[model samples]
Target: MSHRSFRALGVALVVWSAAFTTEQACAETPIEQARHVFETRKYTVVTVQLVIKRQYSFGGRGSQEREEKQEASGTVIDPSGLTVMSLTDVDPTLMYAKLAKTQGMSDYKMESNVTSVTILCDDGSEVEAQVLLRDPDLDLAFIRPSKKPVQPFEHVDLTDAAHPQMLDELLFVNRLGKVARRTYSATLDRVEGIVTKPRTLYIPGQQNQESNAVLGSPAFTLDGRFVGIAAVRADLTESTSLDKGLLAVVMPAEHIAEVAAQVPPLESEGATDGGSS
Candidate 1:
């Protein structure tokens, strides 16, 4: 072979090698960084359980009474054990429907018949909590311990909110249901777009792994900065029924921090009017 042809081949091989190394480095950095973040923040997430009684009607038989339990995920926001969860978990519309049926009333309205609520910690301990308030505008619910904790609980600082650009990679963790031992699984997702009309954020890439059970899970940037909370944007059971299918949205951290800051002062001043036991 000619010396000129040999030199050209050598240049091509070096370029190819450089490209492969760059691709590998780019791929590994984000995932490893995300795993680190998940390990540090996983405990801040908790399980929420609600117990209530509802009435269900049969075709021929009359309505029968039964007790039902619901479960969801929440994020701890403070040392006092203040946590935030998805409003849909205890949505007034659905709760009122159950209540109306139990009362044998025909009108449909919003009401609460929750008999009890409990928070499951990472170490497997449980704490009873009170529902402070549910903001339908934000579609979030705030809850706190009914009694003081023996030790300060682990929480995420919303002040460290992360802002990522479109198509940027991010990290989130989901807890398996009791049937799956309630273990944590880390997922790598991306920001697909942003909505301005409703002041919303969209994550269309993580749809398949999300479920109603994982609502309110905390999301973080690739570097492990807390970004926001994940919520189901459409009907869980009827995803296809919606024109856009099921969308999982992450409420921005700045908005959540602004809302969460209001709760502590209210509790300190002995304001209990907004709470539900």
Candidate 2:
């Protein structure tokens, strides 16, 4: 009888331990759960598009300005349509010129780089978007979809991606925006090299204007937490044009506290796009 009683107690204790663990897991905070998801499923990450209309000298400079539309990509940083983009996508001078005209506040040229405005979702959807804030010196921008758009996307938080260590498996989502075909699942070969340039920027097609910039897409660690914001893919050696075919650039968020503090916590906007090439 004593032996049987001890056996029953041991079984009961095992069951109780398992039950307690499950309860703790189920009671995890949303932030904690989000972080877990980010770490495990970063591949389904999403990006957005910028629909910018600008006028520039075209056709061997007939000395005439022609209007043209250009697109760029962005990473959905939140669920309410807030996103991160490459400030290099917008010419600070042009954004300022456009801003001046829109605000009717003053006529300023090159004063505001043209945040030449437009937006697209990596799931092949297009939404008009506007620049909310910019750090031209750092080549970073925050954007919001216009007309309160709804789209599917996934958001990632920026963590310590720049930490020196082994280069981990990562992914990129590229959106072409009617100019070219969409390409997904471009892997980040490494994260070990450090860039010393102060003003790194991307010009989607300058090196090959036909290339794409899934502008605001997030560069995530294998765990899916946002490690950086996708910027232009440019060669450190050339610095004059983009090399989208062989390279990609990013805005490390760990170093953006100064810029982020200048802006408000943006409204939320995003959805999941977790899949692979």
In terms of lDDT, the best-performing candidate is: 1
Question: What is the lDDT of every predicted structure here?
Answer: 0.72, 0.49
| Number of the predicted model whose TM-score against the real structure is largest | 1
Write the residue-wise lDDT of candidate 2 on 35-151 in tens digits: 564445443344433333334332344333334445555666555566666665554343343334444434333222233455444455656665666765565666665555554
Model 2 sits at a Cα RMSD from the real structure of 11.2
Worst 10 residues of 1 by lDDT: 234-243
Listed per candidate, the RMSD to the true structure in angstroms reads: 8.1, 11.2
